[model samples]
Target: MRLIPTEEQRELAATVRSFVAGRVPMARVREIAGSDEPYDRTAWTRLSSELGLAGLAVPEEHGGSGAGFGEVAAVLEELGAALAPVPYLSVAVAASLLVSLDAKDLLPGVASGEVVAVVARSDGPLPAGRIADRGAWVLEGVVERVPDGPSAGLLLVVASTGEGRRGVFAVEAGAPGLAVMPLTWFDTTRPMARVELGGVPARLLGESDSGAAIDRAADVASVLLAAEQLGGLRRCLDVIVEYAKLRVQFGRFVGSFQAVKHKLADMHCVLEQAESVVRYAVWAADEAPDELPEAAAFAASYLGRAYFQVARDHLLLHGGIGFTWEHDAHLYYKRAKADEVMFGAPRVHRARLAEALGLT
Candidate 1:
C-alpha cells in the first residue's frame, strides 16, 4: 500500500504550512521565547480558533473536525517544521486522553482554544499526597516537567492510588492549590513546568480500572510525537542540503565533496525510514488498537534517535553560524532534544517494547 499522502492531505499540509509561516515566523518564535507569558496565547488562538487545529482529531459531535490521527500528524508536521510553539501536543494529544474516554463536554472549550490542558507523568511510582480525600477527588502533589502547564487552563493529572490503581483526574487551571511554575529547560520554545497541586478540585476520568485506556492515550501521544520528530529531522536535513549547495569550501560547494554527500545521503535514508514508521504509527493509532503500542514504540525509538543525530549533523555542516542564537539551526536542535522525550523517552519506550514482547 502506498504511504504517500492523498491530494486532500497535501492540501491540508500546505494550508497549515502557509498559515504557520504567516502567523508564526522564526522571528515571532524568538519574540515569544523571550516573553514572560511562558506560552504564546495569541499563537495558540490563531491555531486552535482560526485554524481549527486544536479540534482536528476530535469527533464532530464534540465540536471538532472528526478527523483521525493521520490528519493530526499532517498538521503536527507543519508545526514541527516551523518549530511553532503552541500547546497542540498538550491539548490535542494529552487532553485527548479525556476525549478517548468519551468526555465530550470538556471538548468544546478545549477545542475552541478557551482552555489549555497538560498531561503529567514521571518514571517513579505515583506519589502519595497527590490524591485528594474530598468527595470531589482533591489532588495534591508535585508533578515535574509538565509541558505548557504554566499557562494551561486545565490539567489532566495522572496519579496512582493506594492499591496501585492508575487514575486520571481533571483539574481546572485556576482552582485552589494548583500552581504552575516555569522550569529552566534545554528547549526554550516548549516551556515546561513543575506543577504543584494541593486541595485542587478534580473529577475522576473513566473507571478506576482505566489504566489500559491511559496506556492507549500515551501510545497515541507517542506516535504523534514521532511524526513530529520526523518532520523536524527532515527540516534539519533541508537546512543542511541548502547550506551544502551554497557554502563553498576551497573553491567548491561542500555538497560536491564525497564525505558531505554521504552524510546527506545517510540523513535522507534515516528520514525515509522514520517517515514510513510514522505513517504506520499514525495509521495504527486510528485503525489497529492492539498494535498501537508496538507501532508507537518503534516509531518513537527510531525517530527520536534519528532526529537528534540529524540536528547535530546539520549544525556540524553549518559550522560557526549553527552555534549562534541568530541561526535557526539551534532552534531545531533544541526542538529535537525536547521532542525526543515528549510522551515517553526512547529508552522508556524500548523498555515497554521489551515488556510487550515478553523479552524483559
Candidate 2:
C-alpha cells in the first residue's frame, strides 16, 4: 500500500482544511455545539453542494464523485481537526452499508447530502432492536446513543429477525411510533440521541443476511474513524507544541525544559505511528480488501487509545487553562474520548484484532 498520498489526495486534504478553517472555525464550532439545532445545516449544505464531500466515496452512477476511501479519509481528517459538528460519519457509514446492500435508491440522496442517514447499531453495550414482520417489517425496541440520530432523515437499523437471522432495514425518520430524543452528552460537538421504535414500519434494505453487511460497514467506518482520530492527535500535538514554544516559565520558554521536550517528542512519535496505521487502513479500504478487516481493527484499536492519550497530554501541557470550557483543548479531549467509544472501545477492537489473528 502507498504510504505517501498522491498529489490529488494532498490537494483534497488542503482544500478541506482551508474550507473547514474558514467556514467552521473554533468559534463557530463552539456556537453550533451549544445551539438547539442538531448541526449547522448551512455548512453541511456547503460541504455537500460546494465541496461535494457527501459524495466523495459514492459511485458516480449513484450521484457521488466515486472517489475512493483515501479521499474520504482526507475529508474526515480535516473535519476531525476542526471538530466540525456534522453528521458526516453517520451518513458515510449508512452510505457504505447501502452500497454494499445494492440499495441504489438511497445512495443518490445520501450522496447529494439531501438525506442525512445514520445507522442504529451498538454503541458499547447498547443492544439493537428485534425485527418483527406483520405483512411488512417492523422494528421494536430502543437504540441508545445513536450518533446524529435526532437530525437524521434516514436510519439504517440493524435488527434481529428470529431463527438467528439478522437484517438491516431502512426506516424513515419520524416514522409512526418512532421517537428520537437528543441526549445530553459530554461531546457536544457530535450530538447523540436515543431512538425508540414501537413497531415502526421499515423496509428491509436487502436480503436476510444483513448482519454481514453491517459488520463490513462497521469495518469501513472503523478505518475512517481512525483517520479522524489521527487528525485530532496531530492537532493536539501541534497545539501543545505551539503553546509550549510561546509560553514562558522562569524567563525561558517552557518548551526548552527537558521534561517538556521529552513529552512533545513522545507525542510526535505516537502521532507519526498513528498516521502510518491510519494510512494503511485507508489504503486497505481501497486496494487490499483482504487485509481490510485486520487493518481496520488494528487501526481502531491502536489509534483510538493513542489519540486519547495525546489529547489528555495536550490538556496537561496547557496547564490549568485546558480544563476550562472556554479553551479548545477540552473540546478535542472530549472528542477523543467520544471517538474511542463511538464504534467500539479500544479493548473491544483489540479483541477483534486478536480474533482476526487467531490469537483468541
Candidate 3:
C-alpha cells in the first residue's frame, strides 16, 4: 500500500489549505466559536456548491464524483489545520455509513449536501422500551454529545432490538418529540449537542442485523477523527517552531538554544509518525478494507496522545503568550484535549487495537 500521497491528493490538500486560509482563517474560526451555531454557513455553502467537497468521495449515482476516501481524508486534514468550524467530519461519517448500507434515498441528499446528517455514537443500544416495534420505529432516548447534532437535518443511530438484532435508523429534523440542545463544550470549533428523542419516529436504513456495519462506522470515525487531529498537530508544530525562531531570550533567539532545538526535533518526530499512521489508515479505508480496523485503532490511539503532547509543548514553548485566551495556541490545546477523550481516551483505542490484533 502506498503510504505516500499521490500527486493528485497533494494538490487536493493544497487547494483546500489555500481555500481555508483565505476564507475561514483563525479569526473567522474564533468568530464562529463564540457564536451558538459554531459553524460557518457561508463557507459550507461554498464548499458544497463551488468545490463540491461534500460529494468528493461519493459515488456518481449518489450525486458525487465517485472518488475515493483518500481525497476526503486530505480535505479533512486541511480543515483540521485551519480549525475550520464546519460539520464536514460529521457529515462524512454519516454519509459514509449511509453509502455502505445502500440507503439509496438518503445518499443523494447527503452527497449533494442538501441533507446534513450526524451520527449519534451511543454507548449502548436503545432499550427495548426506548424504541417501538411492529414497523413503528419510534425512538425514545437521549444521545448526549452528538457532533454537529444541532445543525444536522438527520440523525443516524444504531439501535438494537434488545433481542440481539441490530439495525441502523434515521430520525429527521423537526420530528415530533425530537430536541437538540447545543452544548457549551470546550472545543467550540466542533460544536456538539444533547439530542433527546421522546417517542420520535424514525426509519430503518439498513439490514436487520447491522453489527458489522456499526463496527465499521466506528473504525471509520476513529481514522477520520485522527486525520483531523493530525492536522491540528501539524499546525501546532508549525506555529511553535516559528515562535521559537522569532522570540528572543537573554538577547538570543529561542530556537537557537540546544534544548529548544531538541524539543522541536522530538515534536517533529511525533508529527511524522502520526502522519504515517493516518495516511495508511486512510488508504486502508477503501483499498484494504479488512486491514482498516487495525490501522484505525493504531492511528486513533497513537495520534490522540501524540497530538496532546505536541499541543502542550506548543503552548509551553510559546512562553506566556500561548497561555493567553487571545492566542490561538490555547485553541489547539483545547482541540487536542477534547480529541484525546473523544473516543474514550487513547488507552481505550489501545485496547481496541489489541483486540483487533487478537492480542487480547
TM-score per candidate, chains pooled: 0.95, 0.97, 0.97
Which candidate tops lDDT?
A: 2
- What is candidate 3's lDDT per residue for 1-360, written digit by digit as tens? 787888998999999999999999999999989877658999998887788888887889989889888888899999999999889998888888888888888888888787888888776545222435675777767877887888899989766655687677788889998898998888878888888878888887777788788889889899999999999999999998988989999999999999999999999999999999999999999799999999999988999999999999999999998889999989999999998888678898899889988999
- Which residue segments of model 1 deviate by more than 4 Å? 127-134
Tell me the lDDT of candidate 1: 0.81
* Count of steric clashes across candidates, in order: 2, 0, 0
lDDT of each: 0.81, 0.88, 0.87
295-340, model 1: which lDDT tens digit per residue?
Answer: 8888888888899999989988898988988898888888888878
265-326, model 2: which lDDT tens digit per residue?
A: 99999998999899999999899988999999999999989999999999999998888988
After superposition, which runs of candidate 3 have C-alpha atoms over 4 Å from their true positions? 124-134
Candidate 3 steric clashes: 0
